[model samples]
Target: MYATLPSPLGTLYIAASDDAILEVDFRDEAMPPCPPASPLLQAACDQLDAYFHGERQRFDLPLAPRGTPFQQEVWQALQSIPCGEHRSYRDIAALIGNPKAMRAVGMANGRNPVAIIIPCHRVIGAGGKLVGYAGGLERKVWLLQHEAGMADH
Candidate 1:
């Protein structure tokens, strides 16, 4: 099941499996915190808070995002993107041995079920403009700035 969570910045979508997290989405809704142990739901909420506060880099929680093999490969590559730098979809496509799969890379990027922790916002357009965030361009911009330490928050 999925639940929306509250944070300093905005609401977060958290989905969990019996073993781990499935997805995390940021949305414009008001919510309260959930317990952070026992139930996977609350634990996901806590991990997400750590991520947004910049206190956590790598995630230890389990994730079971449903996708095609190519999409999973793309998502894995996104996880390897260092905290502050950015990679283009083209760059990821090349790294994954699918140099011609730029759009496919983008498709995978958009389908990333776990949001911020996976760092999909770290991917940019070929020309360096921001593009392709499932969480809306504004939140994408916010995440980039937050990671860059430029967000006014």
Candidate 2:
């Protein structure tokens, strides 16, 4: 099941299974056909709204993103990055116990299905430079800035 929510960045398409969230995407194209509303999806959207409003820092929704083991490890590490803070691909690689997998970590970050909730935007390139984001670099910048602003409060 799935639902769409308007966000500061853009339209957010949230998908979920019966029990856990599967994906949250920012697509400019037409939204795919959606099934009936799922409570899980609605909750995910609600959490995202709180996040964009800076009222929420940590996401408490259940997520079931599908990916390889390495990707799973990378995504889990991403969630550990505190809000308003950032990490590099290299840092994520090391967190996952594979310091040599920086490039692979980047690839996995790009493939992250559950965008904001997974906190993929918190990952950056080396030297604190912004890098690849499936949701566009501009949105990535906005998310980071939004988090920083929230942290100041």
Candidate 3:
């Protein structure tokens, strides 16, 4: 099931199965028609709303992002990052016990199906440069700033 909602970045198309969230896409252009939302999708939307409003810092939704094992490891590592903190691609590789796989980690980070919920925006370049967000760099910057503001509370 899926539903779309307006957000700070743009329209968010949230998809889910009966049990877990599948994806959260940033749709600025035309969007395909979405079906009626399932209960899980509604809950995901509510949590996302709380997140964007700075009333919530952490997401508690059950996510079922589809990817390979290595990608899965990278996504799991991404979720471990604190809401207001950032990590380098190299740091994620090291955390996953593949210190030399920074490039591969970058690839996985780029392919993350769920955007903000997975927190892929928290991953930056090795030298602390902002880079590689599927939602575009501007939205990434906004998200980082939003989280930083929330963390101050």
TM-score of each: 0.86, 0.94, 0.95
Instruction: Let me know the TM-score candidate 2 reaches against the reference structure.
Output: 0.94
Question: Cα lDDT for residue 60, model 3?
Answer: 93
- Per-residue lDDT tens digits of candidate 1, residues 91-120? 999999999999999999998989887889
> Highest TM-score: which candidate?
3
Q: Identify the runs in model 2 with alpha carbons over 4 angstroms from their true place.
A: 30-36
Q: Tell me the tens digit of each residue's lDDT in model 3 across 4-98.
A: 87888888999888899999999999676564468788788888989999998889999999999999999999999999999999999999999
Q: What RMSD, rounded to one decimal, does every model reach?
A: 2.9, 1.7, 1.5
Give the higher-lDDT candidate: 1 or 3: 3
> What Cα-based lDDT does every candidate model obtain?
0.81, 0.89, 0.92
State model 2's lDDT. 0.89
Which residue pairs overlap in candidate 2's backbone?
none
